[model samples]
Target: MSDKITSIVGARPRGHGEAVARILSLAAAPTFAIMALIAAAAPADMLCAAMQGPLSLQGMVPMYALMSAFHLAPWLRLVR
Candidate 1:
């Protein structure tokens, strides 16, 4: 005697969250380093302009925070 079986598929595998976390965490350091280098190499006037420009300090903090969050959130998950 033989038995028949069927398989069903739905959403594709999104991959392990830990994998995403690891990649993001590893990427964060390099990304920050590059950004820091760029900032350091920029002319004083450019840095001042960026600080005083339309975004202003107030806008800059949130933007940076959001970017940092995107970068760190995965790593935080991995740590947990």
Candidate 2:
């Protein structure tokens, strides 16, 4: 398709989250490294305790579990 046609049709475009995901992908390694360092340096107990006061267990656990599955799916196998 030509650019003129696309422009005339008002091409559907990336959403805000998609754009943010692109930016995040560009910096994921450094971001992960910094996060890892922070986690490593923080006291183990404090890491778990830190989020309790502000975060709800009902939402946090399931969200992290789902995200963990998404991130780990490539390396995981399901026999069933």
Candidate 3:
């Protein structure tokens, strides 16, 4: 049984690099959106506390917006 399983596993088709890239791109979409929303809504003080007082959440929103825009452009192209 183990030999049979191993044989089947070995016979399984391999994915192309593009497939992995697409999967990763899709996975990042929602994460970027969520991060954008969180950064936009989170208080700067809270972010500062979480970052041990080095970073500010006020800056997070713009950064997240840019990241979200970067992710969104590809998705929009895919959708169209």
Give the top-scoring candidate (lDDT). Answer: 3
Q: Give the distance in Å from residue 28's predicted Cα in candidate 2 to where it truly belongs.
A: 1.1
- Candidate 1 residue 75 Cα shift, in angstroms, is 12
Off by over 4 Å in 1: 1-15, 46-80
Candidate 1's residue-wise lDDT over 1-80, tens digit each? 01111111112324455444445565784576566556545655655566675555453344544565567764555457
Clashing pairs in 2: none
| Local accuracy by lDDT, each model | 0.50, 0.45, 0.61
- Candidate 2 structure lDDT: 0.45
State TM-scores per candidate: 0.38, 0.30, 0.53
Per-residue lDDT over 7-61 for candidate 3, one digit per residue giving the tens place of the 0 to 100 score = 4334332454445455567667678778879865776576465765344434666
Can you write out model 2's per-residue Cα lDDT over 1-80, one digit (the tens) per residue? 34443443343335555444444443444444455556545654656666555444443444444444455432232112
Clashes of 1: 0
